[model samples]
Target chain A: MKKAKGSVDEFTQAYMEYYSQVFSSILTKVGNAEDARDLCQEVFLIFFDKFEKIENKRAWLYGTLRNVVYRHYAKKDPGVDIDEVFNDVGLTFTNGFRDTRIIISEALEQIECGEDERTMLDLIATHNFTYGNAAGVLGLTRRQVEYKYGQLVKRILEYLNSKGIKDIAELL
Target chain B: MNTSVEQFHQLLGRYKLSRPVSPGDQEYIINSRKQDLKDLLRKKGKYSLILWIVIAIYAGIRKFGIHITMVQSKIIAGMTAVAVVSGSSTGVYQGTKYVIKAISKPPAKVEEKIDEPDSGMTIPDRRTTEEKTKEEKKKSADIKNQDLDATPLSDVPSL
Candidate 1:
């Protein structure tokens, strides 16, 4: 985290620390190693171009990464609307909690939300990002993201209760 | 509310989204980074050279006395100020482009039929050349007709 601070003389340090995580995030979103590699390179080039001006390097990188991935999807299938079609969390659940995950995933999928709402949920929940950082990545103010996340969780819990699945106390 | 949120996050922990970079991708990033940085550094060096050249030219003009001006001191000050600001603020990337154009042979111009796509496939020409030319001609003819119309307050004397 400390290495994410300065870009003046520590570009190499920043790159070494972030390159892998950025690649991984991109790979998960894009689902192709080759495309991910190219997109990751594009993100770095953009970072390089604006190296001097950007602060909160991690947030900015992730933000740019999300746009690049969305653009990649838009390019691949011109007919498909990117936000409408590719707005799922894309997180993989391990076999450990197969049934629970399946139920949860289904409930979340049933809810119709905007792209940023889903992205905010995904980043905060899976990546353990701070609300501020998640908000920054999605180009939302902190309050806006907090509100959206609250609404999202409320909707999910309501949906679950409606389906007669009160709570997964044992899983937690 | 907080407890519920905590429980939600814990549930989310069951799902995962991460992959450590493979050695191959890491190597590519490292190599490409080196090349990119080399280009950036070279551009920086070019900017430095530009600054030095400006300084040298200013010094030469001041010392030679042949480069006299209307107000020598003010002109010198103004020139130096402009030189410094321009040499600093044009950005290294643009400076590199202009410098490269200065040193390298210019490429032959080719008329492009299709504008390049932002990604993936070639861009299709949405409007035909004839359609574009027809619209342009209509615009010019309209302009000419507007100019030919005469209206004036001193109509009797002018007629």
Candidate 2:
């Protein structure tokens, strides 16, 4: 019983450490702060509830977070167009810049390639999420995140180069 | 390859929501022991629900008076527990679907048709267009009329 209690304590500490990162990821995806926080708590709750049943706690966590976010949106606004949320969050991001439209357009165009690459790019550049944390969040190893991030950055650069945008600074 | 580098740079500028949460904020979240308790209770409730559902199903099946061994009873209970959770999840999904469908209705725009009498039959397309135009024209005319009325007739000379 004492050993079980100790293990639970360890799980709780790990959960608290990852809470903010998980909350922010869900918030960005949902574009609503309150709902994101609630869902984040719900994720942790569900995590603890199934703690004994899961083998890879980290992977289960990421999977559960994904499912919770999906289920929340699915319930609140069925068929809520993801593109609209992206546009809204993307616009908020652009508005932070001095030259909102141009820089934003460039940023958006560059990031529009594919899911895994875009996600990797967002984690590294947008959120400043470390490769280690991002990899954990994505159920990947740090080495995998680093490897994929490099590939994604390479692909984005090629796209810009083809468009005659030689330097990233020029886009800015 | 090149596209990814550009994407990385662009994403850097797009980090609007990614601020480092203060230690105080982190502390608050960490200290919310009440929330943790509530969350635990909710899960406990769900598990209780599963247990009750299993009992209910077992009672129903056993109404037939087929005597089962202890091992058989455990297996039936386990299967019933799984069925209860699955049923609840399905209920949640279906309920959410209908709610979303109901809310997605955009408000109906009232448009008057000129080509066809404003009241009766016309293609669904033309009626909406007509109403929009009519509303615009009326709004413009109201603005112009207000402007003319605002200039007192006495200012034009007492004719």
Candidate 3:
């Protein structure tokens, strides 16, 4: 029950505050609940230990989380580099999605699939997870993910096509 | 293979991730924190055990031999400490002064004082040494005469 170097609640409160985002990120990255738990714990343990001296708490946690996730992936598969897809996508459809985004969101929300496929879509389409990473998350093979994810995309496209006049290029 | 498909995939993920996490995920966050606190307490307990062990070892050392002293020795040691603290300052100062003097010895050969003839010096009293002695004796005699003259007339033998 002894407090850490600083106030006792600091680590606990920070744990409560940032754990979800960090856990979600780690889960998204490592694609395993158990590994994400362990890795997120590792990040927070470091955070707890250095809590007193750290300045930018969120930044410190995120930075440490990144390294921890990277190390986890590296240990799992030496060739896997998640950093390549870590950056946000810059596409023509993003900025002016004001009208199209509502349509897209509605269309995507209407489409339903199995929990596995839903989790897969959540990982790949929502969480910025790559096909291989999504496969790892869903416990599916990479080839299966590519095929299924492509089918899902085609379904979404067809749905969009059905809801609209042809020429998908016009939305662009 | 299509650029649009890839962009949509990424874009959808971005929007989904931006939304608030589901309530189910809160359970994970809370459980992990409980684990953190549990592990932290274990670590603190470990450190405290080590600290207590250190304290116990130090207590044992004191109780066994090293710092154990007879009352007489303790009193004597206390008196010695008091003496050193209260009485040593002047001694230290004197010792330091002498040590400084000893360290910086004066240049080996002291310059001898040369004596000169008194002829060059003017004697303010203007009397020769012999005359000075004679004048001193005469002054003492005059003092005696004055003393004799100071006797009261009543003290003279009744005529």
| Highest TM-score against the true fold, candidate | 3
TM-score per prediction, in order, is 0.34, 0.33, 0.36
Cα lDDT tens digits, model 1, B22-141, are 445445443444344345435444223433343334334433423332234345666878998887877776989989988897777998798666687776779989999999999999
Better of 1 and 2 by TM-score: 1
- True interface contacts reproduced by each model, as a fraction? 0.15, 0.11, 0.10
TM-score of chain B of each: 0.18, 0.31, 0.19
- Write model 2 residue lDDT over B1-159, tens digit each, in one string: 446554555545454424333344333433442345345545544324443444334333433433333235457878866899999999999999989988998988999866856666665655577899999999999999999999766755554
Off by over 4 Å in 3: A1-5, A85-172, B1-25, B44-159
Cand. 2 Cα-lDDT: 0.57
RMSD to true structure for each model, in Å: 35.5, 37.2, 22.4
Query: Residue B54 of candidate 3: its Cα lDDT?
Result: 34
Q: Residues A52-73, candidate 3, lDDT per residue (tens digit)?
A: 8898776788789888877877
lDDT per residue, candidate 2, A42-76, as tens digits?
88877766777788665677677778877777787
Model 3: lDDT of residue A150: 79
Estimate the lDDT of model 1: 0.61
| Model 2: reference contacts kept, as a fraction | 0.11
